[model samples]
Target: MEKQHSFWEREEWLKPPDLMIIGGGIVGASTAIFYKKRFPKHDVILVDKGIAPEGASTRNAGFACIGSVSEHLADLAVSGGETVFSRIVRRWNGLQLLRETCGDEVMDYQNTGGYEIFTDEKIYETCAGKIPWFNQKLKERLGLEDVYSEREYEGYPAIFNRVEGAINSGKLMRFLHERFTESGVRTWWNSRVERVEPGSVMFENGFQINPKKTVIAVNGFVQRLVNLPVKPARGFVFVTKPIPGLKWKGTFHFDEGYVYFRNIGERLLLGGGRNVAKEEETTDQFGTNQKIKEYLTRFANVTLNLPEKWEIDVEWSGIMGMTDNKEPVLQEVKPGLWAAAGLSGMGIAIGMQLAKELVSKLED
Candidate 1:
């Protein structure tokens, strides 16, 4: 049964807000923060279906990276040098913005560096040959020198990115949430959105709000509300039981970043194999793909060469939005309706910056 609102609730708390932000992930929270800071007098409310962010924002592998050498080469081929280099700059600047907004200590950010390991010698050689060019371009763009260097790790050919690192995803989101509340933005949890029209949004629970403006920041789930080019890609992750002598302690990627792993103290956290079965993984639903899991399991055993009997302690999957060009989608879908999504699995690196830019557009 619907509980009718009292006079105080209807007139005050239940009244339509100045802005309604759907989806409480990094984009939504950052949007609220920027907007509230700009207009403290206006009431803003952010709603999410889960108690916490349900998408890749908090569920990701916590890799604070721009792009690996091999990944960049592949992207450069498809997107051209100019587009690829511009994206690299955006990612680098976005990472800086995230660290500045939520402090390094608060998020347990570590400059442990990132390594792109390769088992195929030919692929490794090709990537290594492009290191100097990549370094020169990155230096010119980001004012950072020696960004990529050829290296060897555990007997495998690797290219180390000196600027890349890792962070605690949960803590990052927690800090963002604290900032969201501090900025006087209201939050409505477990409130799944049923529909988002031009002027009003209806919740799954039958509650309706007619806000002056609405922003959809659901990422992978954006398609559920409106038609867009963004598509959902499910990625799986698993953390192993404490390995007594785990030595690898930094972010690592392979197979053009289709697979990645890192160390959390004495335990190994591995994720990403969606490229193994792209068609199957391209759905909004959340579940593990056995084929991808099998591939990753083989990689952990054969490529990573873990302890003889290492075991997975926990495993889960997260849904991320993907675009053909691997760029975020930020635009007004219709009058009074806007959307910001398709972070392309780089939410940690670009979510905040994208939010800031979106807020600027909303201002106009």
Candidate 2:
């Protein structure tokens, strides 16, 4: 079929915007929202490749949390205490900002709290030992005392985080889209950006416009657009049919946040087996790995102790942008072209806050 464009459509495509944002995921949407707030009168447009904000934004497990107890301790080992604590603070603050920005009701946010469970006694004991130190260190940053408490949950030894929560990712993204629409910011969904330049955005459909400034927030799809220190790590998430007598509630993590699950109503949503098949799961392609899926299936029943015979209702995958250091990769690649990608599966926690920081730098 021939590509169709009305007279007005052609005019709209040809006109230059004051700011052009590529990608419409949480980071891109957040960037546009922040841009408009900074320059309301200026023309800012968001172009998304999918029908809506695609990739991880609309396709994550919906945990509005940062690192769990063991995960934070492991991070401290790798990046040291200062770097790890600073990141945790940013992620904690980001979740609050998102809750405040989108409002708790519309985003379906639940501060029902979160927990990190461990099957291994050794790891559990190590993590439990750090609770006091972590609580004391983090209290000064997050201003919330007693952040982590060692306890038993659902028959498993777990470390509970008082402030961690979950949010409906769809609702949160919709809230952002609505904010942009209500604020008169133009959004172009189904627009595939081919390349990004200092002041120009070229689409796969042969549409090109030279906006005064451009921001690339494409996340996992960043390789084609820029030479950033990032790569794709695919993740799978599956939901179970409502099981009778479901006892689990609130967000959970195991194996240092690699495996996570939570209750959506009476049903269970579980995901994360990238650690099982690291090489196979490191692609931008969107498909579930068989080994990973099988591992998660057994994990749900055996490890999580969920009732057997509970059928999976749906299964899907998302590509996450990751860096070696696992921190968000934000850089001004060129004079007027900036790229903010590599959220390292922390998009829900850090995407918006990164955009806020990016905009401040953009204005500078």
Candidate 3:
């Protein structure tokens, strides 16, 4: 039995809106703000399943990085040089938009630089050989020479990216939440959308919302709503207790970004390695696997060489939406129904930008 709302309450809060965006994650919330900004007279509403921003938006590792050296090289191998270059440009644009919309200070954004550690001599040599070529291509696009510099850190061999930075993921999401509220966009948390009709949305609680336009921004959870090409890829992460003298600083990626770690003040945050168990890690569940945990523990001990007795403070997993082509699907699926998913684990920077772009297209 569903509790019914009074006529006054229904008229005030349950009425149809001009734009209703599902999934109050980064993309969904930004989409609401963008639409409201473009159409001030229209009523925009954002609904989320959880009370807070669920999915990877708030659970990410907080690395404000575009792409690592080895990751870029792998992308180039698969998508070719031109396509890879264009994707990088989009990532740069996304970063700029994030900074412009939410001030750097509010997001706790910092340009402390980033690094990629080579685990072996062969890998180091292979990446070193391609550094010159890769640097030239990136410099051409960025209009700056020597974006990456090969360096030695402690006993580990690494390459440094001068343009990389870090941010507090919590702060960034909260900042966006506040901005959305200030912009007069209505947000309904704990509202799980069950079905989407042509001009209405059916909620799990038996309530229906008839909005003029609906945007589905659910990333990893898209399969539950639509039959799209998007699939959920799980990423596990763990953090260590504060170390008094941690040698590593800034963000880091190893083995083509399958493994990454970064320092947050005195504590260290490490994540990734879904590539090791691709089949098991493809589910949308947010649980840890013993095999993956063992691998991460070994990497932290051997690769990062953290001191013994450093406690595992916390561990969690996030699901990222990925596609075969590694490109986000940002288009109108049907009449008055739009979607933005398939970020491929690169959603932090690019998701907000895609929202703005989608809003512009919808307005036009």
Candidate 4:
């Protein structure tokens, strides 16, 4: 005898879709939204392995940045000048797309600006030396002059990027989910996609879905689903309770953009120091490193000068996919199994634009 199936489950929920998107983060969600807008009548469904939109999209520091000076220089060395410039353009344009799609008020986007500081004199001089060239290049790309400015704050030497800002990452992800759903795309939450082939996905719950097109948007967890030229880089973050007078009011980066901290309206959110444990930080596991966590804590106390008695309100880890080239992969991994991985820690900055590019490449 055949297993019982409800009418709603057979005709609606379990029905195969024209397009299936794996991993419901910013990229996956935005892809569904864009693809539906292009083909309004197409049936699209997005599924994520977790209950919530995990990964770096909802876990990022909420920075709307186009790479810091040293970060750009580093990428240029690894990925070359042209590629770095183009990546910067994508990230910049992606932020615009995100803002326009979600609206500023909904995401709580703050144009508070960002600053990069250095504690090492050698490193400071190295990055500061590239200020002129970076300003010129960024100006050419962004239509803005004097993008990078040198300044000092609270005994820290820093370079301020006027165009860079921060947003509420949680709110942004919520907005993406709501907006995509409103665009007529269905979503399957807590659905674990265990494996994928050319046209189908196998969920761990013993269910299968065959889609005409499947796009794997799982950034860091790509290894779990398929073989891709990407590796997971884990990061840990902590937010403190509301302090009386938290002077830091904007986003900040240090030590080659690995360390970041910002004020969330009197409460301080800080993370990074993966460099302190690069070997251990390479895993995709969602947990904090003791050494790295302790380092950041000390930095908070000694350098950040947070009141010694302030308590940590919350803390967690996020996994991000990074490629050796520091470039995102938006290629057709298999015949009809296209994938977008390796955002290289810039997922929040470039995920939407990458989705747009990927959607445009598809045949309607």
Candidate 5:
């Protein structure tokens, strides 16, 4: 039997909105907030398939970073200097916008800096050799001087970025939810969208909404809605039981930024071994890759050198949208349908800024 909503419920609670945003992740939340703020008189609604964001928005390692030296060097080779630097600028500015809007206290942001550790001496020398060049380019592009400096960690060569930091991902998303709610944005959780057109969205529960404009901010799940170039890539992360005398703090990355770990108080959070099994991780489905898990376990022991007795407190995975060129996809797809996705893995650094840019276009 089909369920039915009351007339009052349909009219008041489920009334067609001026703008409907599908997906309650960082991009969707930020878009809703900006849209409502710009046009408060317009009715807006944000719907998500899960109780919380089902994507990388909240399921990240919480590094407030642009890129590590080796990561940037690799990216620069593939996409060239112009494209890479432009993306970094957006990332840097996006982090600033996120901090400004949410404030430091609410998100528990800490400027603990970021480090790129190297076990291979050749790779370390290659990245370190480009430090002066990178610093000069970054200074000219982002106006930040001497961003990268040579450093060391536990006998391994490292490069540190003074501006990079860490944040509490859960707190940041909660803060966005509260801000959008306070700004008159209606958020509907556990409301799975079955299909969406330019002006109509059909729900899995046989309900439908006809909005004037619709935005698909689902990131990794965008392909389930439209024919976009973005592809889903799953990442796994784990947290460990508190370790006493854990002096190591701050975000750290290795393997060309494909692997990362950071200190959460006295415990440790480590993730990213996707490159180990890229083909296996290219799905939108959420599940643990045991092979990758075993590889990371060894890495934690051998590379990170964590306490031998440390146990995993929790483990989870998130899906991130990726493009061939490592650029985001923010554009209007149809007459009234828009997409703001393909943040790659930099949603924390670039989600809100992309949202602001997307909302600005809707003004005209």
Candidate 6:
């Protein structure tokens, strides 16, 4: 009788919210804030399965970056010149919006610049030869003549860009959370949403919430609730204990961004290279893969020239949503049910921009 009663019981929580947003990561949190700001009189509720915002928002490499040099070139090859340039503009706009909304101190935003190391001599030569040409093309968009160059920084062979920067990922999310609360937006952590019905939502725990409008911001975890072509791509990362005399500074990307690392104070935080094993890395599961780990380690030694004696103090992984095309889905799945996901690993910048756009759609 007790078990049956638990299954049907609805706790004395408020009846229902006017707006309920699923997945309290960067995208969802931003969406909730946007809705609350637009409709101050209406109640807005945000839900997440974890005690804190999970998935890629907190798990990213803290790269306050839009694109690396070679990575931009690779994107042009795949997406064409027009598409690649347009995407870069969008990323820049998103970054600007994030800074304006949250402020630099709150987000720990820094413009210490970034680097791309070239371990392979041929790739290095190719990138060096095209630096001027690439810079000329992006000059108008970036408002800078020389966007990249071979600069000797510390002891690494790196191509540096003065435009990029980094941020404290954890602090950024917390700032957004605080902003939401201040705006009278309600959030329910550790609340697992199972289904989204018209004007209502069913929770895994026996609680059902009836909201006038719902926005799904689950990102890579969307497959759990809807039938989308989005799939999860796992990114493995590890941080080193603070080295007293670490020479490297700023962010670094190699092998066309397949491998990436950056300096956080005196410690090194490294991640990426899932392209080494596409099939195995494409899963909703959040765990470090041995193959990717080995590759990252090898890249660290060869590219960054890290000593084998260095200890890996922490290791973790986060899943990113990817689709056939890199564009995110920001449309109403059904009447009263809107979704904004599939960031293709560019969630930090794009998610914030889309969140504002999503709320504007609802207001219309």
Model 1 misplacement above 4 A: none
lDDT per residue for candidate 5 within 236-317, as digits (tens), equals 9999999887756889999889999999999999999999999999999999999989999999999878877989999999
| Per-model TM-score on C-alpha atoms | 0.98, 0.96, 0.97, 0.96, 0.98, 0.93
Give residue 77's lDDT in candidate 4 (0 to 100).
77
TM-score of candidate 3 versus the correct structure, residues matched by position: 0.97
Model 2 residue 264 lDDT score: 96
CA error at residue 97 for candidate 3, angstroms: 1.1
Residue 148 lDDT (model 1): 89
Which stretches in model 4 have alpha-carbon errors above 4 Å? 1-3
Of 3 and 6, the candidate ranking higher by TM-score: 3
Across residues 1-364, which tens digit of lDDT does each residue of candidate 6 receive?
4343332344434567778999988899889788888888988889898898888999998887777778887877788888777777777789888889889998788898888887567877777787887788778887876878887655546788877888899999999999999998878889989988668898998777788889999989898887777888888899988877776778888777877788889899999989999899888788989988898888777767775677789999998999776778887888898888898888777889989999999953
TM-score of 6: 0.93
> In candidate 4, what are the lDDT values of residues 29-99, reduced to their tens digit?
88988998899999999998788988889888888888788888777777788998888888888899888
Candidate 3: count the clashes: 0
Q: Which ten residues in a row have the lowest lDDT in candidate 6?
A: 2-11
Looking at candidate 4, the ten consecutive residues that score lowest on lDDT are: 70-79
Instruction: Score each candidate by Cα lDDT.
Output: 0.92, 0.89, 0.87, 0.88, 0.92, 0.83
How far residue 138's Cα lies from its native spot in candidate 1, in Å, is 0.6
The model with the greater TM-score, 2 or 5, is 5
TM-score of 5: 0.98
